[model samples]
Target: MSQGIEAADDLAPEIRQFHEAINSGYAAHPPQPGQTMADRRQVAERVRAPWAAGGPAMARTDELRVGPRGVRIRIHRPVLDRGLPSLLYIHGGGWMLFSLDTHDRLMREYAARAGIAVIGVDYSLSPEAKFPTALEEIVSVIDWLRQDGAGAGLDPSRIAIAGDSAGANMAVAANLLLRRQAKPLLDGMLLNYGAFDHAVTPSHQRYGGDGYMLNSAEMVVFWDAYLRGPADYEDPLAVPLRADLQGLPPAFLAIAGCDILADGNLSMAAALRAAGVPVVANLYEGASHSFLEAVSISPLADRALTESATWLARRLGRTCG
Candidate 1:
């Protein structure tokens, strides 16, 4: 075993293999021009996610304008016949990359696992549209759903918001705003290894350097891209840990055991509990950040998603067959 993988003895063997595969890919095709956001995204495209493929058949999608910006969304229906609970899923790309297309297979699997219609929201990315832009887009989508589900085959009254990484950050922040404005309420939230705070945690200091798919340094770049200025870090809409946790939706925080954001996820769950919010926090022992992206191959990832779906199914008053 190489020194790097040996150092990660705490991680499960499969998790170690996952990281090794990532490293092998990087070695074969080292990242060039990886300094900028665009360049990094281009480099990321080379690492294949086999687990994201071969999901159940995809439901038809429709393009709609939630806000005046011609913002679009891709809606997927579970195999269930009747109207189903809806999940507004945000794709994680550190707030700069990935799209509905990039995350389609993963969303389809979630719909199949949870037996619910999934609305893959294509919110604005960062650097160009920072802070409130994406949050405002989320509000518009929720408002549109509340007013007119627009034949999206969803139980409008029962809806949950979910995301991974930066997307989870948005889900947490948007929940607070939606409740405060009384625009529309989210039933629950699904946060998978979310970075809830701007500050560094022990996990960041320990695993932020390398081996993990998501490094602490890369996240610093993501945050800098997502935030317009230093002041944005203190904004509740950006840094949700700084906000009061009262009255937010119940949450399912799926923690990656080796992630830099694990500590933050733990803190968020604890804070929610202290605030009297129902919380289900699970740590996929030995899994690294974004392991869910390998749902096809990672048993741990599949288990985490299935359990999260079960909790969300009950929370939304639905059953996943």
Candidate 2:
């Protein structure tokens, strides 16, 4: 069985309260007629503003371009280590929404609490950018880090990768691509409540509906917006769970026990283990998908992030204190 927080007898009260609060807010401010995707995105950002506000100070921060896709990335280094280990951090929003601005605080926390550097990739979003595009952009970030991390103030060998939801999928896909090129470009991976393959699973059957922040129906809409066609669903890079796991780096996967995507995380850890990749998997009972967004308020989210960071830090020889 997996270690860390096990699925509890009942949902955590903080998470339950968060669920009720969001449900009530959504009910009170029902969507307007003809609300565009942009509109929904703006609303999501506004609602998340409070949780995403403020964080530990960084010693250095820089914005740079990776390549022609115009993918911009923000690099954050901790005050303690000028040459800190780094991780390419991708944000989660069903691959359609959220960005560096939305996940700024989250990255800062990892940089500070885990004593590592963080590069937050501002890759293009979907219905405009589509699948593979964001994936390609992340691979570009990984390539650039491998080439110029020393110049950019990060330790190359210690550079790992991480993300929540679709962002995590991109991290895994990027690692697979680099591996194929005979350039294994990661020290470790942190996947939090990821959406692996589009197929249904037992966890989906148990927790895939009604106020989990990422219900099964919304996931369908997300996949449709993120992918170009049905064929993209089967692409190993696009699905990640469909890809072979051999030769992958060590991984720390965080599963929200009540999340619809819990089974995906479980399956991925199992596959990695079967392939002989070291894996440390955690199941945070009753935590919602993207609940890491509530780091300041939820003890479970804070603890899970700390533990995942610690696991990766130990593997990469960084400090998780």
- What lDDT score belongs to each candidate, Candidate 1 first? 0.79, 0.81
lDDT of 1 by residue, 150-254 (tens): 465667788899998888998998888886787656999999888789788898887777567777777888899899998998988899988898888889999
* TM-score, cand. 2: 0.92
Error of 2 at 187 (Å): 0.7
> What local lDDT score does residue 45 receive in model 1, on the 0 to 100 scale?
58
Local lDDT at 320 for model 2: 71
Q: Tell me the spans in candidate 1 whose CA falls farther than 4 Å from its real position.
A: 1-7, 27-29, 33-36, 80-82
lDDT of 2 by residue, 12-98 (tens): 777766565555545545689999989877777766666678867887888998765667999887774556788889999898887
TM-score of 1: 0.91
TM-scores of all candidate predictions against the true structure: 0.91, 0.92
Query: Following a full C-alpha superposition, what root-mean-square deviation does model 2 have from the true structure?
Result: 4.3
- Tell how far residue 181 is off in model 2, in angstroms: 2.8
The CA lDDT at 299 in model 1 is: 81
